[model samples]
Target: MTISCPTCKKPSAPRAENKAFPFCSERCRLIDLGDWLSESYRVPVGPDATERDGVSEDEAAGRVRTPDDLPN
Candidate 1:
């Protein structure tokens, strides 16, 4: 099967010896890696504003109000 490189748009032959399977060459592979490291690619967390550790914004906001809320 023949595959085209996403970066260079070059046609590449499919073979077990091809280290850069999808990419045509090492340069294209490295470019893709650089994009990942530079934050060009983003994986969405979610719509909620809460922290990943389960700390909600409202809970954090409530911690600072009123002397009665403080522990002895």
Candidate 2:
């Protein structure tokens, strides 16, 4: 199926030959990585998130920030 690359928005089909499948190229893939490293990207917490669930936003964010949880 044809899909647009997430980083470049270039339309292409996902193929095993492309190491960066969701992105247009390695350049676009690296640009996305840099954005995340610089904190230009952030996972938005849902509006319904609350302490009532016994998990505050800060605590959940901390859990995700661990190096072990980071993509290789």
Candidate 3:
């Protein structure tokens, strides 16, 4: 059985033998990771998630989103 590489559209068979699995090579896998890192791909989320993400993003960037977040 054979499968197609998600990155390059190449045939990749024998999943157990291919360390890259869904991708054809380490290069393809890294390329896919880069795409995700660059925001080339986005995952769908709900309104609740988006709201939570805003707070999390601010905190991750060492920001204080609200007055209550200020250090005492």
Index of the highest-TM-score prediction: 3
Q: Over all chains combined, what TM-score does candidate 3 have?
A: 0.49
Please give, for residues 1-72, the per-residue lDDT of candidate 1 as tens digits: 679987678986575766886888777777777677886553333585335445565677867778787796
Displacement of the residue 19 alpha carbon in candidate 3, Å: 0.5
How does each model score on TM-score?
0.46, 0.47, 0.49
What is the lDDT of every predicted structure here? 0.69, 0.69, 0.73
Residue 42 C-alpha lDDT in model 1? 32
Which tens-of-lDDT digit does each residue in 37-70 have in candidate 3? 8874533334544667777888888854778877
Clashes of each: 0, 0, 0
Candidate number that wins on lDDT, 1 or 3: 3
Model 3, residue 23: displacement in angstroms? 0.8
Off by over 4 Å in 1: 39-72
Error of 3 at 15 (Å): 1.6
Worst 10 residues of 2 by lDDT: 42-51
Candidate 2 deviant stretches above 4 angstroms: 40-72
User: What ranking emerges by TM-score with the best candidate at the front?
Assistant: 3, 2, 1
